[model samples]
Target: MALDKQDLLFAGLMGSKAVNLIQNANIVNNELINRVLPVIPFLPVKNEKNNVTSKSGHAINAEDNWTTRDSIEDQKQFFPLSFSFKENGQKWLFPYEPMINIASGNSIVKRNVAKQGDKLIGTIKERWSRKDFDITVTGVLIGSIMQGKPEDCFPREHFSKLFEFLKHSKEIFIYCHPLDLISVNKVVVEDYSFPFTKGENVQAYELKLTSDYSYELLIKDDF
Candidate 1:
């Protein structure tokens, strides 16, 4: 299908996946994290590769049956923050993010204090380094809200995936509205742990992270 304003809007919300419109639209609504106002998209012409009828199973035209993703639609709601960070082109959709805090600063010191003419002065020094950043994110996972089947809504798999990231030594690409405010693209998981919670099927998680920025030669010599 030809591109149009509606298609672009879908692109803005779903990223590249908008082309598929909503794959699995046939699935139950509760199974999907996107429980928001429905938006329409113009799907591409069905080809052999997309024989490929997973989303909605209708490739001929845009469908009003599709709904918007909570995470992608807005961040101000904060009831359930959507996918924040990704790695290798995959985004981690947070079911219900309660809070996300980012703290950033730099170390500048004062030295060489001296008394001169009944006055005191000190020299200030700063090193060429990236600003320090610390991030904390808390989210609640719910499987018993009758939102979906336990197999689909449970947090056990989410917990395992989170642990995998924590155990991974390498830095992972991360982005959210808050992280974007400070230009933080990647971070190292300093510590991760599960906090006390009150639900039989609800799990709370706490993730601590420090920023990681690899410096590259921005000014290359043009020969």
Candidate 2:
């Protein structure tokens, strides 16, 4: 069916999969962890291979018939998202976009090549390395409530979950989306930077992770 402008726009918006979620993270100490961040307003990167050079000369060296061959080579995927929070009478200013890293297996070619007719037949299958990813969540903390009193500006309890995670190691499930999940990943805090003033606010946060679950586990959730 031919699509109109409105249809195309809707597909672009919905099919883009702008929405993403992190189901739940491990608890460090007694502080609760943060989940759910906004996907940065940008296009998701996809590394794709449309064709491959023929290594086997089955067709008299006539280009080896590279028709219907493609693949995606990125084993790891990264995303930039926005996060903000208001707590302890202080509102943290989201200075810059935060990046979330996702690890995935590569797509592979599963075609049967006929040496006589130079024909290729089969399907492209995406191989998932694991369902779980050991992901470290980190972001920048630029500005906070400036007009508040000293006591209010600095809460009695600092947002120390990051520190707790650093000291206490734990594995938790992270929902990449509602149906998709990265489960039982060892999560930790790393590469934290002190706040610095820039045009907006700039600071850095980092997390370290590893996983054994498949990246596409959600597809088979029913089983």
Candidate 3:
């Protein structure tokens, strides 16, 4: 069928408009993809709180991780990070966290001996007390040299900060893979030491920590 010039012109205009709309839609989609891609990698870690020994329902958000050294964007995602500590709006992360050894034992009391004169019957199991768990960690503070980074020096800053945690004597919200598996979350640093090691960029340290049980005490009214 033959069409008028006006009809042909109208059709061309409509096609142009449709093309512009499609172009705009593509631009928007690209922008959305760019924004969402970054967030996808940082969408936070799994929710594992079944083993929080400190308090009921204490949360440990693993997404609050960051690297100490700068690297390419592609490598940023690969930067090693293992341990996460968060408490009262403050967070502490080990950029290259490494737990060399983990030792755990429960504090328990088993009363097995009765008085010397008591009946020789099977030992009386009168007293039984199972306290908190003792957690020992042999952690390594990774520095530049280990990753072949620029410098070959120990991570003094991280070491100092870790000691700071021990000195403060505050209960910390800790998230660690091994500890998490056994439902351990909150902990208190009872002791720590930086043992001598032959590493220019790494320092080995030992930590004696105990599982923390948080409690609130009510006080009497004051005038």
Candidate 4:
């Protein structure tokens, strides 16, 4: 069947409009992808609480009452970050965004059994009643190191030794509270001190570890 000129022109216009619609959709999709990709690191929620130890060797749950800005948007704007290392090719990359646990106020005690001078004995007695605290770190994993070569991600040297240790391990151990699993975020390492952030949306996230450290070793050995 033969179509009139007007009908043919209308069909051509519709086709052009459809093509423009598709191009616009593609552009929108690409923009969304780019916006979301960089947000992955900040997405995982990390929750941590405090534990207090008594001089009698008993431990108690201490409140995690550290305060921070309420909104996630505020956190994104003000989150303080430190650097760590990852291996690439023949050298190490500095300042990789590796997962780490920051534990504060952990302590150990020793009893004095020997009798001493009056002042010394008094000091020991006072010490026995006092509690000590220190900060310790554990469960460091380099995300960029474990993942494929970063397109242009810079690495940091602070994590060099930790990266090496993870490289040689067969299995990494994670300790976490059972209750944390059911919460919004999974706790990666157990018994780590986490500062408190305020707001209704505040939550916790679990850190990732691997049973096979070989992958880490391969990446580190690349350098």
Top candidate by lDDT: 1
Q: Over the stretch 70-147, how does candidate 2's per-residue lDDT look in tens digits?
A: 111122212222111211222222223234566655445455445635353454344433334435454543222212
Q: Of models 1 and 2, which has the larger lDDT?
A: 1
TM-score of each candidate? 0.54, 0.30, 0.47, 0.19
Give the per-residue lDDT digits (tens) of candidate 3, residues 17-79: 334444444445454334211211112243344221121111322233322231113233222
What's each prediction's clash count? 4, 10, 1, 18
The residue-by-residue lDDT of candidate 1 on 26-66, one tens digit each, is: 34333432443222222433344421222222232223222
Highest TM-score against the true fold, candidate:
1
Better of 3 and 4 by lDDT: 3
User: lDDT-based ranking, best first?
Assistant: 1, 3, 2, 4
lDDT accuracy of residue 161 in candidate 1? 65
Q: Order of candidates by TM-score, top first? A: 1, 3, 2, 4
| Model 1: per-residue Cα lDDT at residue 180 | 71
Against the true structure, candidate 1 has what lDDT? 0.52
How does residue 19 of candidate 3 score in lDDT? 42
- The alpha-carbon deviation from the true structure for residue 93 of candidate 1, after best TM-score superposition, in angstroms, is 0.9
Compared with the true structure, all predictions reach lDDT values of: 0.52, 0.32, 0.48, 0.28
lDDT score, candidate 1, position 107: 66
Worst 10 residues of 1 by lDDT: 51-60
